[model samples]
Target: MAFSQQLPQGVTDLYADDYELKQALTGQLQHVISSYGYQPIQTPTFEYYDLFMNVPGTMNSDQMIKLIDRDGKVLVLRPDATVPIARMVAQSQSEVETYNKFLYVTNIFRMESGESDRSSRSFSQVGVEWFDDAHPLNDIEMIVMAIESLKQSGLKNIQLELGQAGFFQSLLQEAGLTIEQQLVVQQKVDEKNEYELSRLLTQYQVNDQIKNQLIQLPSLFGSPNYVITEAEKIAVNRGMKQSLKRLVELVNQLEQLGYAHYISIDLGLVNHLNYYSGTMFQGYIEGYGKPIIQGGRYDQLTKYFDLETSAIGFGIYLDDLISIVKKQQSFKTNQLETVDVVTEEKDFVKAMEFAQELRGKGVVVNMHYENDSTTGDPVIYLSEKKVEIKGETFTFTTVEDFLTKAGFKNGNN
Candidate 1:
């Protein structure tokens, strides 16, 4: 096997228009996030292995790419931004204010065991974390921002399905299921496999009342009004009731904001990350089967770092986003036009001067000696007294006259 010619599985190289379009999408999302007061921040590409290993629910250890440092400390490529950002916030708790907001566009590396071609071991994520604010309004703000960010990326027909992790967790506790049993049930519910979920609940010999509710979990999704009303009827315990109340508040507020049309409910929409302690949501664009955005409230994650702060955040799968945007042709790349300048050896210095001037005026200029093949829009033939553009030749007395004759208005074509 030739290592040089082959990229590792689940990785890819991006170039040309694809890369430019990805950048354009990222910029649009960043602008949206920043507009909401999220200041950009970055974490190292790798961190000590224990940083993640110690934090259960962050990610599976086996999925992490690891290495050993000189002193024999284990390190893993950063698999998640939220966890590390939480760690950073905790470490700087004394220095910074109690509340903070951060945004990031970073790469995440992890091993995907068995995934489709759409899955990449390395991918970029655009996300934001709001710290120390657990009010329902904060949750509303995050969801609103998520919708706006997706719209900014030129995605229409977007649907954000909201769920409550606490609601599901409360039901699990009432069912008295062991950790292993809980995982099996959670997977079935997350998949919306009601048949399997019913079989599992019956096998566990869960209480008749609780088992009935568990069986209906998969079907507990639709419009916010319908799901919420139905979920209230099954509210089995205090925790479940409280979680539902939070959902109600969020839905009411979102409706007032005129975003109810974009909102849906999914009581069974459980996130694989165990850190989520409250509302969990995912955004899907029409025609795309997988979610482009996912997030939730994980008020307890910072406690693992010895800080008691509430937080919520989401990551937009940039690779997936780029694919959808390209398919829709919704986003236009702000690619600059390149102009090629052709000149003789004796006039090279003059050509260089003219090229710099054009560049200063916001045009992309490429220099070429007359015989050199050029690859740019609008080739310019520069000599002592004549100028040529688009097969039309003319004589100009000054650079300003040349600019006017070439039809460069306001420093650009």
Candidate 2:
């Protein structure tokens, strides 16, 4: 039994010019990540289920798209990229004194509710992972590289919202709520429902000061100085103060780095990705309601692999970003390199020779065996005693004459 002429829910195909545009954008992403000295890596689309099973702060069990291996092992379509990269780095024998930088342009799969129209089952991600580097400067570089990568996509009017997930985690620790209570408060805060947060705090018996801090967390966003000043006043523990100080220094250095204009601080901009152990950031451009870019530091995650690595990274959601690139700029995706070489049946030899020469010269040559309908592309037609280019026909002569009149002064040479 088959559904007639329909794709699986939330899965659609891409072809022709759309695929080309995606490839071009992917090249740009790879080039930018490479320019920053990050090596490119490709991981399998699926991995063993155990990779994520013990990893706290990652996806829940139900979220994974599960499969059964031949050996009866449970496998999953990769729900995230960073964890796989961590596993790779952990198993490597390469001796590195300081750090490792890797970037991957890959697809991730997660089960989605196509019925509710919340998301798609598949997505393209361009991301980087810097391993074993805890210096705050490394964090800043990750942010700057994210900005530059978006810029490479020809996107403008970009804004990146910065936050400290560690600060929020520290606050939760200071509150000392039970896991059930914490989960309730986290859900309320994650939804940005201050009213609900208020209600939850009211029901829970915590210190009033901690309750007030959590309630006000939603409003704690502004320019750097203002945000830091306000955060410093209420940050309860040493971790909270340290988180604030790090953010302040990050802003100051970014100012000196001359990227202050594109930066904004949002103390309330907590990401739901619980892996983020420190600074977290999200990027947005005009015409898109959701952030197209997101990444953060997750120092605790690598410990599950027992590698003792501390790192930070981010990924540009290249799937949704293509729409933004198209909407923000005027561009051409139909760049053709091959000129169709049409020939009369008898002149096939000549056409083949010309195509061979063109190929030797690193030019793409499309043989037009029988044209149906293709317009606005370069074509070279050969027949009994004539060759044609453009709309004007030319005498049967050397490829040099064709090159000369085609405005290639040194084309023949």
The number of the candidate with the highest lDDT is: 1
My TM-score estimates for the predictions, one after another, are 0.93, 0.90
Q: What lDDT does candidate 1 reach at residue 50?
A: 95
- State the lDDT of candidate 2 residue by residue for 162-239, as single tens digits: 999878889989787887788778767866789989888878877889999998888887678778888988988998
lDDT of 1 at 33: 94
| Best model per TM-score | 1
RMSD to the native, candidate 1? 2.2
Worst 10 residues of 2 by lDDT: 404-413
What local distance difference test score does each model get?
Answer: 0.86, 0.80
